[model samples]
Structures are given as C-alpha cells and as structure tokens.
Target: MSKQASAAIWLWLAVAVFVLDIATKQLAEMLLVYAQPVEILPVLNFTLLYNPGAAFSFLADQSGWQRWFFTAIKLAVSIMLIVWITRLPRTLLWLPAALALILGGALGNLFDRVLFGHVIDFISVHWQNAYFPAFNLADSAISIGAVMMVVDVIRETWHDWRQRR
Candidate 1:
C-alpha cells in the first residue's frame, strides 16, 4: 500500500471549534435559565436549551431511546469524517477543512450526548413570529464548513468546464 498524504494542517481549526463549542455551551448553561431568552440584538437571542435529538430537534419527542441512538450515529459519522479529511488530496484543500470542521462539531456535540443525554444550544435568531432553532458554535462551524465545501465544488466545476472548452 502506498503512503497517503495527510491533511493535518487544518486539524487545529477543528480543535478550536471543539474547544469553543464546549466553553460557550458551559457559559450558556451557567448564565441562562430554562425557557428564558436574553436578547443580544434585534434579531439574536441567547436562550439555553437542551436538545435530546439531532439537528432541528428531530426525534426530540422520542421515548428516550433516541439519545443513545444519536450518540452512536454521531460517533460513527465523526470517525468517518476524520478518515475522509486525512484521505483528501492537497489540491482539494477546502475538502479537508470542511470535513475536519464537521468532524469536530460532531464530536463536540457527541461529548454532550454521551455524558448528558442532550446537546446544549444557546444561540437563537428570529424575525417577528418566525423563529429559528437555537444552535451552538459547533453547529455554526459545521454550517460554515458545509457552505465552503459547496463553494469549492462550484469553483471546481467551473474550472473543469473552462478547461474542457
């Protein structure tokens, strides 16, 4: 088997995400009370909530089994993302960063899920009566990374098309 080049440089960003996520969640837990929203801006609020399910509180109403189920899935996915990051080529730089961010975010929440049976979410946004689900730094990093990957895909597609012309 040939030796593979690792995309380890971007792993620091992942660590940062994990650390920040944990710290912020801890602060949110300590500072905010249940069901109370602290307005930070016109559209932003810090509202502490414990989600027992996946993104957007999916399966949150399940009969308590979803906690362990989600934990297992998060572990599997986080491992897979780490493997994917290491396998990524240097030229596809954004791919590794994106995968690493997703991995870190997943692990951050996985830590909570395994220990507390829930993920702490504090950030909230709303417009009039329309409200978005509260999320944390991990979720934000994952989302930004995903968008970066999408942009990378579009850039590559355009480059390939130009080359083929």
Candidate 2:
C-alpha cells in the first residue's frame, strides 16, 4: 500500500481506539460514581478508581506537583509519537499503527488528568485473594501497543538479519 494510505489506516485505527477509550471511561464515571466493587466472576470485577499519577499509581502520594509533571510528560510523548508515525515507512504499518494506538491512549488519559485531575479506571481482575489494580480502556490500549511494538521490532530485526546473510 502507498504511504499515504498506510498513514490513513493508522490514523483511523487511532481514532476508533480513542473514541472507545473515552466512551468507556465516561460510562464508568457516570454509572460507577465511586461505587463499591462489583464482582463479575471468580477472577474479574469492576471498581471505580481515579488515578492522579502514572501507571501503578506512581507518585500517587506525592504533593500536587506530580500531577502536572505526568500531564506534561504525556503531552510530550504524544507529540513525539505523532512525529515518529509520520516518518514511518509505508511497509511498517503494524509498527506505526501500534504507535498511533499508544499515542491516542496517552492523549486520552492526559485529557482526563488535565481536565479532571485524575483518570477514571473501572476494570479489575484478580486471582483468588490477589487482586490487580483497576484500569481503563486507555491503559489497555497502551499496554497492547507496547507489546505490538516489541513484536514488530523483533520481527523486523530477524528479517534484516536474514536478508544480510
């Protein structure tokens, strides 16, 4: 496919993911309202939580400065990803799409932090007595994007190595 077409595909994928992430978060905020955790199954639950820090509640207990710091960092990362996506080769569709998803997810969470002082998280999973912290669609997108980028890198490296032999 042409470079323009590939970029368009990535752009659309990002838009779809962003819309889904924002909609789910809004639903969580409106319906959950800091509600008590609701168990969906033996290993899954839904709980409303607001995060003012980065992943795993990094800097969650710090003074107010960390909120702005994380917001700024997310904005910077989003900008960098957009620029990098534009420069990506047409054949690197998978990698560029992954980056776009990560960028969109970052922007979504950043928007919440800047506008609401925290990110809405509602999905929770656990194993017996052990529980994972609640998360939202935006976080999931970022995690998936990161994993896809790693796979893309490994595949590209292996292809290049084979070509050089």
Candidate 3:
C-alpha cells in the first residue's frame, strides 16, 4: 500500500478517537455539573471537571505558565507518535493501534488545552470515600494505548527469546 493509504488507515482511527472524545466531553458538559458527580455505578461516576495542569494535577498551582508548556509538550509528543505510527507496518496490528490511540488522545486534549486553556474531564472512579482522579475518554485512550505498548514490547521480547533459543 501507498504511504498515504497506510497513514490514512491509522489516522482515521485517530480521528475517530478524537471525535468521540470531543463528543463525550460535550455530553458530559451538558449532562453533568462541574465537580458535582452523578454515580453511574457503585464505583464509577460521571462528573465534569477541568484540569489546568499535567496528569494528576501536576503544576496546577503554577502561574498560568503550565498550560502553554503542556500544550507544546503534547504537540511534540503527538508528532513523534504519529511518525511512529506511520513507520510501522500495518501487519503489526497492536503496535499501530496503540500509537494511533495515543496520538488521537494527545490531539484531543491538545485541542482542549489550546482552545479552552484546560482539559474537560468527567469520568470518576472511587471506592467508598477514596476517589481516583477524574478523567475523560482521551485519558482512557492514552492509558489503554500505553498498556498495549507494553504488551507489544513483551510479545516482541518473547519472540526474540524463542528465536535465540
């Protein structure tokens, strides 16, 4: 396949993830109140929240500098991830999927940070009185992508080991 076609297949997946993330954020905005959570399950809740900093509220107390910094970082990382995706053969299923997911999620939050100066987060998980940080679909995508990357690495290592043996 042509490079464009190859990129297209993966990029389309990224676009889908990006679009879905935005749509879900919009739905959360309309259906939920900011920081006021509605329980969707015993351990999960839908809540609208914004994060001005990096993951886990890192540097949130900074004097408005973190937003641009993070936006730049995400853009740089996104470019690298896209390049990684395009370089991979489509025969490598999980690797490309993982990279596309990370790229899509990065762009999704990049849009929010650039346009709105923060990310819209809604999904919340908790146990009893303990609460995990609220996150959105973009975050979920990124997390899953990271996990898939680990799986790919493990698989590759195992294959190499077997070949050597």
Best by TM-score: 3
> Against the true structure, whose lDDT is highest?
3
Better of 2 and 3 by lDDT: 3
* Model 2 residue 1 lDDT score: 36
lDDT of 3 by residue, 59-152 (tens): 8788989999999999999989877777766666788988889889999999999999999999999999999988889999999999999999
Residue-level error in angstroms, candidate 2, position 98 = 0.5
Question: What tens-digit string does per-residue lDDT give for candidate 1 at 50-70?
Answer: 999899999999989999999
Off by over 4 Å in 3: 1-8
TM-score, candidate 3, is 0.94
Query: Model 2 segments beyond 4 Å from truth?
Result: 1-8
TM per candidate: 0.93, 0.91, 0.94
- Model 1 lDDT, residue 2, Cα: 31
Candidate 2 backbone collisions, by pair: none
Candidate 1 deviates by what RMSD? 1.5
Candidate 2 per-residue lDDT over residues 1-165, each given as its tens digit: 344533535767677777898898888778775858888888988889988878978877888788899989998998888878877766667888899889878988887899888888899999988888778888998999999999998999999999999
What is the clash count for each candidate, in the order shown? 0, 0, 0
Candidate ordering by lDDT (highest first) = 3, 1, 2
